[model samples]
Structures are given as structure tokens and as C-alpha cells.
Target: MSQDYSSRGSVSRIDASISVPVRTFIFSSLLWLLVASVLSLIVALKLQVPSFLGECPWFTYGRIETLQRNAFIYGWASNALFALNLWIMSSLARFELKSSWLPVLGGIVWNLTLTYGLIQVLLGQLNGFALLEMPKEVAPAMVVAFLFAALWPAVAFARRPTGNVFVSQWYIIGATFVFPVITVVAQLMLLWCPTLGVMQALVHSWFYQNLILLWLGGSALSAVYYFVAKESGRTISAYYLATVGFWTLFLFASWTGPATLLGGPIPVWLQSVGVVAALLMLVPTVITAVNIFGTLAPRNGIAQAWNNTTLRFVLVGAISFTLSALLNIVFSTRSLNALVRFTPFGQAQEHLAIYSFVSMVIFGAAYYILPRLTGSFWPSAKLVHLHFWSCAAGSLLFVVAGLTQGWAAHGRTDFAVSALPGLLAASLLLVGHFAFALNALGMLAADKAPSNRRSY
Candidate 1:
């Protein structure tokens, strides 16, 4: 009897059987996050010690902030999702890559864009809007890189038998296919083929929201659904219900970003709709989170056994998925929104979404991916533990400090350290940065070689 795991529509096995390219993508993403994390800290430090790295034009706060965002979002988060989607497609279709070269090319282009984009940002020509900071030149490159990158999985899934679609597959495969399409269209319309006076502000808002919710956020959720459901060892009781969640989310959350940019000059209707849609988004996010966590409820049993690095990282991601969504909703509120619009609080929200929610999921995927690709477990479990703790602790501290200090700045609280000391907010951020740096070092040092194969 060929113990047919696929027959039952199970993808649990794929976690243990990823290829080298898939694994490399995972590692590279972590590396990006790890490095970007350091830049974030340095940027924070520059806040307090304005003259610490004085006149080193390249190391200015402005430059480092942009670099940190680029590395974390595009370099780290995007790469991780790209790699995991490849693995998911391969498993769903039961097919090996026809040519890994395409993926390699994709990765090259993606990294090149990140490198070039950072250089431009450091040189101070970045567009510099909250969440839309990547310059137009770099944005177009991202479109090309992402399109090329999305192809591998498109091929992988295309080859699969239609009957094999699992709930996880829908989100994973569908998201991979959807992202390139949405991003490509958004980039073209918003950047390349601009139509003058055609609700430019509205279009811009839609593009930003979709890039995040439709492309990045959707991709992030797709992986969470897969890993969480799989890790839970339960076949998400209601696949159809999930489709309901997806489409509803697509329709509602898709239009809310422009609204989030409320108080700006967009039409009243657009902003109003955004506020409503943002709240409505809670429906999907909450439903999905409840279902996933419910499936994984008695989390101790099977999860305890696979206390592997990959599982732990993903678990954090899964939990964060819900938390970040909740945070987005809070920030989405006009009452709270006004306070955090341009403050570090907005940065905190992005980091939580990208770092804790998205990156954590990718980290989990890497943990599961590396052992198979390299034909070895991570060199050290302890090292992985260190990486895990450092990242977790650092992110928690950063978000908490940023939000609190941001409010202090906004409120102009006389008692708030920031009111008395000009450096108070920045100083809090610097402390968080120091913690972030320690975590990054932990990530770099986490890799280990097999002990017995000293000469290999």
C-alpha cells in the first residue's frame, strides 16, 4: 500500500520536503529582516545621539529609516512569501520545479531592486510618504521582479490535478497568483501609466491598500492559514467558509486604505467607505483567526512534538496575524488615527505587521524548510532558540515603546518624558533599537553546521 497522504488532501508532509531554492529564499528573507533590523536600531540611535555618527551623510536618520523599511518589507517579507508559496505550490501539485533557474533569476532581480532602492533612499531621493516611500524608479523595478518571481508557483500549480485543491491551497496558490496580478496592475496604473486628474489621490490610496492588504497582507495570511492549519493537524473544518472569508475580505478591506488616509483631500465618500470597510475587515480577520486557533486549540499535543524552530516561528506568526489585524483596526479609527498619522506609532504598526506578523511566519517556514534543503537540521537548536527569543522580545519592546512614546509626543503630555526632554521619544526608540540589534546578531549566529561532518 502506498501510504497515500495526498489522497486525503494533506500537505503536512511538504513541510518536511522542501528543495534548496525554497530553503535559500527562506534563509535570505531572514537575513534581510535580520540586517534591516540593525539599520532600524541605528536609525533610532541617531534620534538621541544626533552627533554620534555626525556628517556621515550615508548614516543619517532619514537614510537609515528608509533603508530599514525597504529591507524589512520588500527584502525580508516579500522574499519569504515568495519562497514559501513555491514550496506550497510544489506540494499541492505534487511536482518538482521544472526549472529552478527561473526562481534563481527572480531572487536575483528582487535582491538587486532592494539593493538599488536602498542606495537611492540613502542618497535622499526617496518619495518619502508613509507606506509609499519606495521611489517610482524602484517601484517599477519591484513590479518586474515580482512578476518574474510569481511565475514559478504559477507553473507549479498549473501542473496540479484540479481535485487536489485544499483550503490552504486556495489561499496559498490563489494569493500567489493574485499578488502579481494586483501589484502589476496597481504599479502600472499608479506609477507608470498615470492618468492625470483621474482621482489620482483615490487611485494612490487604492494602490497602497491593495499592495498591502491584497498583495503583501494576503500573501502573509495565505501562509499563516497553511502553516497554522497544517501545524494544528486539522483539516480546517470549513473550507467553503474560508472562501467566504477570502472574498468578503477582498471586497471590503480592498477599499479601505484610501479611507484610512482620511482628512486628506479625497472625496468624502471614499474616506467614509474606507472607514466602514476597515471595520468590516474585522469580520474576516476575526473569523479566520478563530477558526485557525480553534483548530490548533489543544496546541500542546502534536505541536509539542514538533517543537522545531519552524513550528515555533510560525506559531508566533499565526498569533500575530490576529493581533496585527486588531491593531490595524484600532489605528484605522479616526479618533485614534489622527494621533498616530505621522508619528512613530505608524511605524510601530508597520513593524508589528511586517516583523511580528509576516516575518515571524516566514521565520517558521525557514525553520521547517532549511533542514530539508540543506539535508541538515539547523546547526543548533539552542541558537535557534536564541534567535527566537531575541526577535520576540525585541519586537514586543519596539512596538510597545513606539506606540506609547508616539502618544506622548502627540498628546504633548507635560508629565511625559518627551514633553520635558526633546530626546525622550527618540531615547525610548533607541533602547528598542538596541534590543533589536541583539536579536539580529542572534539571527546571524543561529546557523550551525552538523558537528560530525567537520571536514565536509
Candidate 2:
């Protein structure tokens, strides 16, 4: 007899099978988020007041910045994405996950390795590359741990009961396959073998761009597609365009890496090609934005749409994703790039894409996923609102300040005036991080309180 796990009522079963691993990932991610936020605050403060932590070697700006980036990417982003991807794939496949212990074990190893790697970074053993700072010795273990964590989900996707795979599944699967290859290859080339001269810069630049676009960007898009479709209860508009958009991103995004290296030692022709690729990225961006926005349009009413906190966050993130793409395209242009290349505009753009777009969408996904997994609603709408508003406001403040500083620094030689805006931006970001941590803690506490009360 064929095992039938595709019943519409199998959500509980799916949740049950995946809950342990999912919760593990989420809880660990939140904890890391708090740690990363503290690191970020320190990095921000150092920018404004260089002597604030100057006495400590571990607290130096370079080490702290590297630690913060690694923490956010590996600690927060990796765990959350794994959780989201697992849930999305399982739900779409209409099958309970098999061998859940694999992921749980994988998660334990992943976190342990991450902790060790982070400590190494703090001890000034950094690889001196953006997003690739995790030590080479630990790199292979991370890859192994990730594969361990990701294996079950990939198997579930392959053994999907449903033949009709959705766009979300496509993106998640693509990301799952792509991330490990990119990570291992990048580490080997840049960290282990050590590429020659400018080649190292090129590889580093390529790795960073691909990490953001293929892994983070792909995962964020998957969350957006899944949540927007589920919450809106609407079919994606121009569904065929999603295929086009996905292919466009997969094919062209790698080429956009050289755009960051414009005016560097790389060939002018390569930079020009990157510029074209970056500009062409707008195609997929527009396609995705239009498709998702159309699905998210008020099918019932505006008030109803606004009432859904998850949808609201996803909407904001979707908009930011589009805006980020546009900004990237504009900045890739020689004239605009020449103006903003040395300024805080680059940081502003990174914040917009990573935190505003990617993290916000993941937050929305978590909001939707957590309640179902725990069989409970969020503890407090007030806290949710606080988290949302603070993040939104702080991101806006941070981006605006960065842009302002970028514009101001264009002509001036002294950076004193420009640094003021960065200080303000950092303060706003700290407040936002506090709000996020508090909201997460409140949710966890609330989730646990009912059980404790029952026992008492």
C-alpha cells in the first residue's frame, strides 16, 4: 500500500514531524540575533567614537565588524532560512518530514561550529573578507553541518507527494543546492589556496554578491512567495513570469558581482558587463514585485489586509526589495557609482537589501510559522507593533542618514561632518535591535507560560 501523507488535514502531522528541528533553529536564531545585535551596536559605536572600545583587541573596529557580519549571516540568517525553507518545502510537498533527527543533529553541530568560528573571529583570526571571515579550518565543518541540516529537507522535496511544485519550492530548492557549493568553493579559493593578487579581490567580490543574491535573496523571495500566496489566498498573477524571473536571477545575478569592482584593478570590459547585468536585474525585480504585489492586493478589503501583520511586513519588504534593485541599478551606472562608491551609500544599500528587505520578509515568515508550530497566537499585538514600527522607522532613519552623509561627503575632504549622520543611524539601529529582541523574548515567554501555568 502506498503511504498517503498528502491529506489536506496533515498539517498537524507535518508540523509535528518538523517542530523539534524547526523550534531549535528558531530559538537558536533568536539567541544569535541578540548576540549579533550587541556586536553590531559595538561596531556602530566604534564608528562614532573610535576610542570607546579602543583598549580591547577583541573590541577593535575591524574584528567587531567582522564578528557582527558573521554572526548575523551565519547565526541569524542561516538558521532562520533553514527553518523557513524546511517549513515551506514540507508544506508544499504535503508530506511529513522523514528522519527529523538528521536536521536536529545537524543544527547542533552547525551552532557549535558557528560558536567556535565566531570566537576565532573575535580573537583576531579573521580571513579579512566580507562574509567570508569564518576561518578556513572551520569552513569544511560548516559545509558538512549545513549538508547534514539540509539533507532531510532536500529529501522531503524530492519525495514530494504533490507533483505540482510551486514557485516557492523552486526558489527554496535552488537556494538549498546553491549555498553549499558557493560557500565551499569560495572558502577553498580565497581562504585555502589563496588566489593571486587582484584575482583574490575578484573572487571575494563574486562570492559576496552571489551569497547575497543567490542564497539570501533566493530564500527571501521564497518566503515572500509562500507567505503572500498563503495569506492573500490568491493565485500569483502572471505565474509564468515567475519562471522567467527565477531564470533571469539565476543566469544574470552572478555577472552583477563585477559591478562592485568597477574602477578597481579588474578589466574595464568586465566592469561594463557587470553594469549591464546589474541594470538587467531590474527585469526580474520588476517581474517579482508586480507578481507579488498583484497577489497581495486587497482581495477582500484594505482594512483586512492591514490587519494582517505578517502580510504588512512582507509588503514592506517586497517594496524595499524592488527599491533596492532599482538603487543598485542606478548606482551601477558609472556616473552615479563614481559619486557614491566611497561613501556610506554602499552601506545604505546593503542595509536596505539585507535588513530591510531580507530580514523583514523572514520576520514575516516567522510570525506566520511560529503560531502554527506552537499552536498559539502571538502573545501581544503591542509588542509586534513595537517590533514592526521600530524596525521600519530605524531602517528609514538609518538609510536616510547614510544617504545624506554620502551626498555630503561627495565634495568634502574631512569626514567629521559626515560621521554625525552615521552616529544617528547607529543609535536608531540599536533601538530597533532592542525592540526586536524584546518582542522575540516576549513571544517565547508567552509560549512557555501556559504550560507552566497548567502545571502549577
Backbone clash pairs for candidate 1 read 379-448
Highest-scoring model, TM-score: 2
Report, for every candidate in turn, its global Cα lDDT versus the true structure: 0.64, 0.80
lDDT of 2 by residue, 1-456 (tens): 132333422226677678778888888888888787778777766766779889889888888888888888889988999999998888788667667888989999999999999899888888778988877888789889999886565787889876787898888888888888888888988988888888888888788888898889998999998888787778888898999999898888888989998899988998999999999998899899878877766555335556888888888888889988899998999998988897888988988898889888988888887766665557667778877887787778768767776877776544555666556655665666666666666666556522321111
Which whole-number lDDT from 0 to 100 does residue 231 have in model 2? Answer: 78
* Model 1 misplacement above 4 A: 1-20, 130-135, 193-201, 298-308, 411-456
lDDT of 1 by residue, 157-208 (tens): 6677565665555666556665656656655666677656646567666766
Query: What global local distance difference test value does model 1 have?
Result: 0.64
